[model samples]
Target chain A: QKEVEQDPGPLSVPEGAIVSLNCTYSNSAFQYFMWYRQYSRKGPELLMYTYSSGNKEDGRFTAQVDKSSKYISLFIRDSQPSDSATYLCACKINTGTASKLTFGTGTRLQVTL
Target chain B: SAVISQKPSRDICQRGTSLTIQCQVDSQVTMMFWYRQQPGQSLTLIATANQGSEATYESGFVIDKFPISRPNLTFSTLTVSNMSPEDSSIYLCSVDGGSDTQYFGPGTRLTVL
Candidate 1:
């Protein structure tokens, strides 16, 4: 099984709607969880990052992690057209050196007007 | 966040040819990473480049295929050797931001025809 699993969603939603993107990981050693946003033909940008099994809120975006279940989520409030992008969930273990990240398949979100 | 830039933002190359993507960061960093994002797929780590050391590649990646050069802390290059259609993907470079975060470059989109 892949280390991280996410729905490859082209989820369409209306503006002002709430969007929830999630991923499940299989590695218990993963100590950090991150969410990245990628636009068309662009690189992935770090959106939210969480270290513990709790919710971390930054403005309109919230990242939640459940270490027990190895589940992570990113919630976007008042979604806008500009929020249309692919959301990727990444997990990382604390290797002594520079650690590599394990990414999910990414869920594509399109917020329409 | 570290400002990162990549050269040859987009390119088309023939099969069996090679393309080297350059990554430059605004500040000196300890760890640099190379990743590949194929169409409709998630980002997969290719290797980790550390200055003054041989690059450490992940499983399924080899130095012969994706050779990396980290001559300095602020710059790195990844060459896709003997490219094929399967090598057609967006290559991205990322820096390790303290506190378990990573900042990504704009990415080089390569199409092997």
Candidate 2:
């Protein structure tokens, strides 16, 4: 089984709607969770990051992690057309000299007017 | 967040040829990573580059197919050798930004024809 699993969603939503993206991992050693946004033909940009199991809010984006369940989520409030992109969930160990990131198949989100 | 840039943002190369993508960071970092993202797939790590040593590649990736160079803390390069259509993908370089975060460069989109 893959260490991380995410729904490859081409989820479509109208403007002003709420969006939820999620991922699950089997690695218990993962302590840092992150979400990234990538537009077409662009690189992945770090969107939200949380340490261990907890919730973190940044602007309209909120990230939640449940270590007990090995699951994480990103919530977007009042989604806009500009929010349309691929969202990737990534996890890694918190401490290491050379830490590597494990990524999940991204969820494609489209917010229409 | 560290600012990262990549050269030859998009390129079309003939099969059996080679292409080298360069990555430059705004600040020095201890470790750098190379990743490949094929169409509709998750980002897969190719290798980890540590300055002053040979790159450590992940399984299914090899030194001959994807040779990496980390001459210094702020710069690295990944060369896709003897390219094939299967090698066509977006190549990205990332720097560890401390605290479980990684900053990515604008990816190099490669197309093998």
- Report, to 2 decimal places, the DockQ of model 2: 0.82
What's the TM for chain B in candidate 2? Answer: 0.98
What is the RMSD of candidate 1? Answer: 0.8
Interface DockQ per candidate:
0.81, 0.82
Top candidate on TM-score is 1
lDDT of 2 by residue, A29-97 (tens): 998899999998889999988885788999999999999999999999999999999999999876667
List per-prediction Cα lDDT, in the order shown.
Answer: 0.94, 0.93
Q: Tens-digit lDDT track for model 2 on B65-113? A: 9999999999999999999999989999999898778989989999999
Q: Indicate the fraction of true inter-chain contacts that candidate 2 also forms.
A: 0.79
lDDT of 2: 0.93
List candidate 2 segments past 4 Å from native.
none
Write model 1 residue lDDT over B1-113, tens digit each, in one string.
99999998999999999899999999999999999998877799999999999999999999999999999999999999999999999999999998899999989999999
> Least lDDT summed over 10 consecutive residues: which range in candidate 2 chain B?
B95-104
